[model samples]
Target: MPEVLFPLDSSKPFTDQEKIGHNRWHPDIPPVATIKPGTTFRADCREWFDGAINNDDSADDIRDAPLNKVHALAGPFAVEGAEPGDLLIVDIVDLGPIPQEEGSLAGQGWGYTGIFAQNNGGGFLTEQFPDAYKAVWDFQGSECTSRHIPHVKFTGIHHPGLMGTAPSAELLKKWNKREGDLIATDPHRVPALALPPEPDGAILGSLSGAEFDRVASEAARTAPPRENGGNQDIKNLTKGSRVFYPVFVPGGHLSVGDLHFSQGDGEITFCGAIEMGGYIDLHVDIIKGGMEKYGVSENAIFMPGRGGPVYSEWLAFSGTSVTLEGEQRYLDSQLAYQRAILHAIDYLTKFGYTPEQAYLLLGAAPIEGRFSGVVDIPNSCATVYLPTEIFDFDIRPGADGPTQIDPGMGAPRSANPNL
Candidate 1:
């Protein structure tokens, strides 16, 4: 079927705390038609700034811009028929990064805070590796110099800052009642969901327990309106990935914000190619039977070769193991891995695969089984992998017969002696 386009505009500026509730923003160009299981729609997205930052802005200008205006989303597109129990499957068809026009002073480039800070301030490395850094580059010139050092090569790519479905009203309300005040009114309440500490005490969205506790504690102290609830700045998702979200209400209230030019895994410096303003094209579909019973209720599915959804896969396996382990060493890393394998077996058996077949596949297929953090106390590990390529093969459905024979016996017997 032909793809439809949906354009959305935000009604008001959304904070990291207020974005949790539903229908916060209105759709500018409503869906020309309803989207179903097979229906596909192309969503056009504007930059996080919503066109605020421009090429003419300087490093000082960027550093001085208001935090509230940083990452703006394009829409609250309605997925017709989407309900609490349904799944919204989004296929990233294509992404077009905003190009840096020639001769434009817009510091259009890709880098995290470290790269930018190093460029502006000649810190530790400037004295020792005097020739390693450069503040600016001449795009047209074939050669460029950085403090007498010569270099070449420049390409810019922008990625989404934040992209996720709206949380349920109940979940949002609970979160607000628990952590709203700290995020809204208390400057000391900035929790560390993913960022690091800046000189200003707490950097919003940082990933730290202390920061998170302060934010949560503050939220409990004073109840603020639903802010950007369920909002986080994850820059790992790029082109060629699929993000599947669970529908919490009819029409699956969907929204996206935060745009980056590029970022590394883990987003170490807490900031990335922080350039704003760009276009994105997203395809929407419905996933059949994609939700779990409880615990964080969102199912994000990435396509083949794209590892963006690794977190979701790990969570699924971890949750299963947690339930199975009960009080028996559930906190142990090695034990958890073993239990996870058992969980996988149980899952496969439910799909009609024999225990033996499940075991074979678990060992042979792309199922990831590994020990990651054994050095730290209460070591933790995981073994789980999803093979997107398996669907492309056309192999026979049943198990093979025994391949060995008993020399003492007259002839070989089937492994399944019952047969």
Candidate 2:
């Protein structure tokens, strides 16, 4: 257990005190608490749904989680001695899910994974994955166990899905304008799905039923990361990772939420690996004029190692395409990489990775990528390798999965050369 920094009891659940929490990330929101540099604290946290979806939820129940009411954040816990232009260093100490059993809604001890419907039009592969789906996970110390999401049987790496300091007024204005421009460009707002503010903390960011006088929106969104660092679902930011954020506001109104029991790099599915409620043990420090020293603006993170890397052998998949050469083929990598990843993701689903689960697996698990062949005429090749040793159970190519020669693929595409 981490040392609690708030006036509240450590034994209490974070969801139990909604008033102390926050959904918006604006600098205007009142700070919950303030601490100087080198301050360490234990923060109890919640899932993206803010406790709505839970274990035993049907696929429908999970998919229905309001998209507008996205990631419910915790704390604008102000850093006392921090200021703008400086860098805020958050050293992640530890993380674990809430362990609750036998309840209409149980969390902390376990978490759930979900894929929304295409009607909502969310997620990276929303078109291919048109239906709603759900899977539950039970998290013990250091690992997550789930029979629901098949194929993976490794101990999980627990990390917060969203963590960062508050955005300044300038940044908020810029976000609104950019999002507005994007919305104007396309009404659907495909990939540039900017979160506009909505009434009610998105799920209330306050203490024990108390409401903050604000709306939850893009600035508060636990989605795209900014200089202040909101939601950059990097799976490697686990215990011992040193995260650096460029301070934008005074006291660096720091907030954290969107805890993931586990996740992969791409977070391809909008939902993510295993959405769970957990606790964060963080050590906060301020680096004077550090942002200036870095020679660039915006927030960035430095990870020493995620739960320490485990060396292992891998099963690799190759992707072939036209022209790895020249600027005209910049889009080739996108097509090639997408094909390779899809191949890998589809292959994993056979052994328990749901389309969504498999997407998450490709991200969270230690996979490597390489450019295999560039000399094959006008073709370039890439490969994404999955470590075979990561799976605790013996993982043979299951019946459900398509082998290397999946239909429409595997055959050399040398006819049109660019095909």
Candidate 3:
């Protein structure tokens, strides 16, 4: 019989800290269970605020919500037989929202603020909309009625906030020590000691040594981890999508938190598409050669790859450049650009297209590239766009299967070649 790993419980608030340890599994510390590839598990996830904030709650409610109590998730269940250097293929079978109180809004819209910025600009409304800005505009009113843009479709996609194997014990230990030391230091010592005497002078002494020690103790409790082992918000895993994670320790302790309903790419504002929760159905499958490549790395997920000769309404290129002062910034920018393009080409070639063919296709299409950001360290990124009308081929299918090529790869390739 299939096991009910994380059963649904509606009696408790979702974001309660005590609930995380009770509901989720950690890989390195202890083993949850061992399961075969086809084993299915159920996850009972909580709303983003664990019922702290409601849909009818105002922005003030969000601002006042406890920061630590936000973004709760369920389970780090172990897939039996999953070992190091193996991949756990997860297939999402079903996701449903458990009915809440009558006036409660359990699941709602989903999207990321960062993705919105990619399409729009990054700024508050003062900068985003300076003049004639209407706080609430009616679509059926004169302005929108005269415009050609019409409402099409809207979807709310749900995905996890945090999902990954626990870090090795050694790493966690080192993190505790380093962060612990920093937290033991006081931030207000210098100012407190340097305060000038008032005219009605009462010389205020510095904090007692014992008081300083206490301050450090409190700060240490809230210090960010010395290592990046804490919560990570990767908004890619959605309902019906599969995530392959690398296993570290036995039972591959896995923990998840931070649930968003729908989000755009980039997640710029540190907030996600929509913060809500419901139920998630997870099927854990073990794959050989999957675990060896686990953990966050440069080449893991967001590798540069050519997407198309597929059509786009408009073509645009975007990139970022980094510079070392007193050195060649432009040269570095050029090198970064080349690297990004090469990476894209390398990714595209994996789809069975010859290097030369991919290059030609990129050149023939209405491609445009531009700089994205340059202020960060080793700044870099480049995006090329090609108009959809130029190429009669599809790029979406390339993700699932091998690309089909004509007998002789050339400008006039087959319109529909058998794969």
Clash totals, every prediction: 27, 22, 37
Candidate numbers, best TM-score first, in rank order: 2, 3, 1
Better of 2 and 3 by TM-score: 2
Q: What local lDDT does model 1 show for residue 38?
A: 53
Cα lDDT for residue 81, candidate 3: 74
| Regions of model 3 farther than 4 Å from truth | 1-4, 15-34, 99-105, 108-153, 174-232, 288-290, 293-419
Report the candidate with higher TM-score, 1 versus 3. Answer: 3
Error of 1 at 379 (Å): 9.8
Query: How many Å off is the CA of 35 in candidate 1?
Result: 3.8
Candidate 2 or 1, higher lDDT: 2
* Per-model CA lDDT versus the true structure: 0.38, 0.64, 0.39
lDDT tens digits, residues 22-66, model 2? Answer: 665677677777777777888766666656775663565544666
Best by TM-score: 2
lDDT of 3 by residue, 122-214 (tens): 111112211110000012110111001111122333455555554444544454456445545753431121111111211111222554343
lDDT of 1 by residue, 1-419 (tens): 23524333333222332322112221121222345555555544444434433333133432333333333444556676677666677765555433443322222332212211222222221222111111222222211111111111222223565666555556545554454343445544222221221223222222346644444332211101122222343443566667667766567756554555433222222232333333466677765445653322544544432532232222135322243425533346656565556566566545444433333333322234455545544435555443333322212234652222111211111122211
**Compared to the true structure, candidate 2 yields what TM-score?**
0.80
Candidate that would win on lDDT: 2
